[model samples]
Target: MRGARRVPRRRVIQRLVAGMTVGVLTTAIVFAAMGWFPFSALRPREVQVAETARIAALPTTIGFHDPDSYFMNDADVNQTFDKMLATGVKNVRLMMPWAGAEPVQNQFDWTNIDRTVNAAAARNMAVVGIINASPQWAVAPGVPAISGRPASPAQYADFCAKVAARYKGKVSAYEVWNEPNGAQFFAPQPDAPGYTELLKAAYPKIKAADPNTTVIGGVVGSVTDWGTWLVNPVSFVQQMYDSGAKNFMDALSFHPYHYTLKFSDGMAVANSPLDQTVALRRIMIANGDASKKIWATEYGEPMTATDEAGQAAYIADLLTKWQEMPYTGPIMIHTTRDRQTGSTDPENVFGVYRTDWTAKPAQVVMKDAIAAGIPKSPEFQRFSAITDPSYGEVLTPVYRATPTVWAQARTVSTLFETPTGIIASPTAVADKARQFGGIPKTPFQNGYQDFDLPSGMRIWWSPATGAHAVGGGFVQAWVPQLGMALTDEVRDGWSTKVTFEHGYITWMPWVGFQVTMT
Candidate 1:
């Protein structure tokens, strides 16, 4: 007896039985929750399809920066034109320098111009010839020399009429001026009066020559405080409207360049172009032009040599978001080729293609993005999972679990049971949960437990608490230790029989409950 050791056989048996009970109960509970159990009397109803508005076809136009320069060498111009055609580009915005086209009074040279048109047409790309800048003949003889400001309204109108008549049928659209709000282009005086006069004179001639062609005005440069230059885009638009010039144009064009005062410094904030575009849209809506569409005539992301990838991602996201908006129409990236000067702007790195005719990584990404359609962001994906239940098989309640609480969180996962014999944190349980569909609410805490009930059914613990859970259903949870957060959650129908350890808080308005039967 002294040599024999005593053993707790009953305790060992009890522990084994408890472990077996948890295993069996978990399987039964999962089956019950999934409506697979024979005793399951309730089933989740099918999720409703969300209403999505049909998006209009977005215009794909590439800015042909300094066409005058590109066409300088016939061989180079022909090669570039052929390449553009091969790229599947359907449209080009060609900058037609008023000074260059009409260098001498009433003396017009259409040699290079005809070459450009014929070349583009051969590739089947529609041309949007932008007439900008003033020659010495059109302006005051002794007026200060500037870049794009036209000299006289009458001369500018005459030049526009000639351009319209020459390319009436071939050109798709005509933009009257470029960055008229900027001192660099519309300088001497950046006032809207001069611009309105130019539009009034040019729009009629364009329409008269070719009724099929579209004439657009207001190629206002960036969203700067135009007031500083004695011109506000909103006010300028109003002036144009008041001047009866609004009806003359088919679309309103704007550059919307998010130019940083940093002068190509690497530290400038990105998304400036998008922000300016939104502001322009708001201005248009505020001014009673809701029906009119906006054309981003010259939008771009100027990236530093090292930040090309970031630039590509930014461009992709911007274009995708732009396509989603209702009023947005036609966005033309600034340039097809890098500036010859290797500068960050005008001669800077905004070109999608390198000077050597190689496609920049950004260019490749852009082409891929356009061909692949809008990219789905992670935020959008999570939102969709919460709002679209039929999109996947996982229960919404199980999909929304916090990743820190659940180690099984994957791109997709299904929840089946609660851990009792095997202790799992709340975050671990939530990481395996599916998110509920529809608009997202606040976050809450959830707990899991199990109970053996009558009818061979088991009651599984499913409880939620927190800011999101306060409104009901699955709530997002945050675990600071893991530096992880649960974006969404769903309370599966199986949880109906199980009592919550902690009651959920209701912060949102009460929506009627949906019951399902299988």
Candidate 2:
């Protein structure tokens, strides 16, 4: 399976050094006197989307919204991930139940997240980390439900920063909150302004942590049935832009799951995507956000257990329809495996595979589609098995997880400096450390840090010369293969520098910094 290549230590240092320059990755960032960054200081840079491509990447790394991602143990995580890879799907949309990860204020348990992310990385899969729900402690004081909005949007935003810092490279995309249009996820009521406030707060923080990580907004639930709990998503999303939602998102996420609608229905649902989603796009186009992509965040049809052929038909139909749409990116099915042990649960029927991890016709369809490069197929308007009451049943799912490690307390003080500065977390620096050959012998001091590469050659950071990390362009492509920094950050006028065995890398303001060979 093709996975992300691990850059050699020499190459890692080389790239950072090569790419390390002001205005490349981001405007050279500066820390406040007390190392505190106000939200204003963290305003998210506009997202940079890749060119629209055929099939959204070869073999189409279709996204799958894995169910109960938070509850899985390590073994089950691996099992589930392997199954997904087998289906030719390499991108996953996972729920990061915020309350579970952060039961206590300012404290986080990364055990499950670590497993989930590392598992995906090991398989060369990219993950979309969806931060969801309000932590009980952070819920609005007057609101009684745990699902209520946070007491302060900043609190949520800060939490988002911490998550992004921790999983910068491993998780490439983030959705601020899920399905705010659906009252169930947002609770109390779906408040567009409230969700907008959250986006406003979190957007800059996540972007500040890693500008390359895709930040998606308008995580709207598909509008089908309407009640006090639901509003027209199309109308609601337009309200988001009215609330100035465009400033924060790089892409828009749409969950067009009209559970009762036929798969062949496409985005043509009467009150749903055909109307609302289309309107949402027009809002983007009107607002000059045409370059932003639209993601089918979650779309799946429920059927009786015996409706294998029906499920297969839906998959075929969705792939063809989705491929034909230019702006639509990542058709993430609602699931990978059945979620229940019995047919009594409607959710169980959404998986491409049966509960036992055995291939259903849907699974076969998925495999064949991947192999055949998703050729056009007939769409399904109806599945007969769904109408039949005799076919519903479920088997015990395979691969139960027995987690060996659970999350424990970890703090920001545990973090280390990265090419960016002291702000990048230790975990985010893990790969850099690996690629740099070894950890720095000297502790990071002042504003600079160093690494010990092989061959007596070293690399360092300075206010005069940026580290080797370039933003998304040329600097990334240019660098000396390997070296290490032997010294900590040392102040130099208004900037700083780190001394490597080879030379000094400096960082200042607009002029940036430069490297001088010893």
Best by lDDT: 2
Whole-model lDDT, candidate 1?
0.49
Worst 10 residues of 1 by lDDT: 4-13
Q: How many residue pairs of model 2 clash at the backbone?
A: 33
Give the per-residue lDDT digits (tens) of candidate 1, residues 1-518.
Answer: 01111111111101111221223244334333322232332332222222211222253333344343324456766777665654445567675655445444555545456666666666666777778756544555434322436666777887788787777667778888876665556656576767888888888887888787778888765543534453445556666667676666777876554422211211112223443444456556556676777776666656543366665665554555554345656767656666552564343566677778887776776666556655654433433344233222211112212322221111222222223222222332332222221111212223322222221111122433321222223222212222212222244553322113333212223533332221
* Model 2 lDDT tens row, 1-518: 00211111110001112222223112122111111122233332222222211224222447678845546778888888899889887788776656545544554555556667777777777788888656556775545323556768998898899788777766778898887776666757788888899999999999999777888888886664356577667777778888999889988988755444443342222453433555576678778887787787777656652366776776666666555444566778867887763575556567777789887777777777767777633211112112222222111011001121111001111122223332221322322343433444345454333443443322334435434322212122224532444454567798767555566667677856666667
lDDT of 2 at 180: 78
Off by over 4 Å in 2: 1-60, 142-146, 224-227, 266-269, 376-518
TM-score of each: 0.58, 0.60
In Å, residue 111's CA in model 1 sits off its true spot by 1.6
lDDT of each: 0.49, 0.57
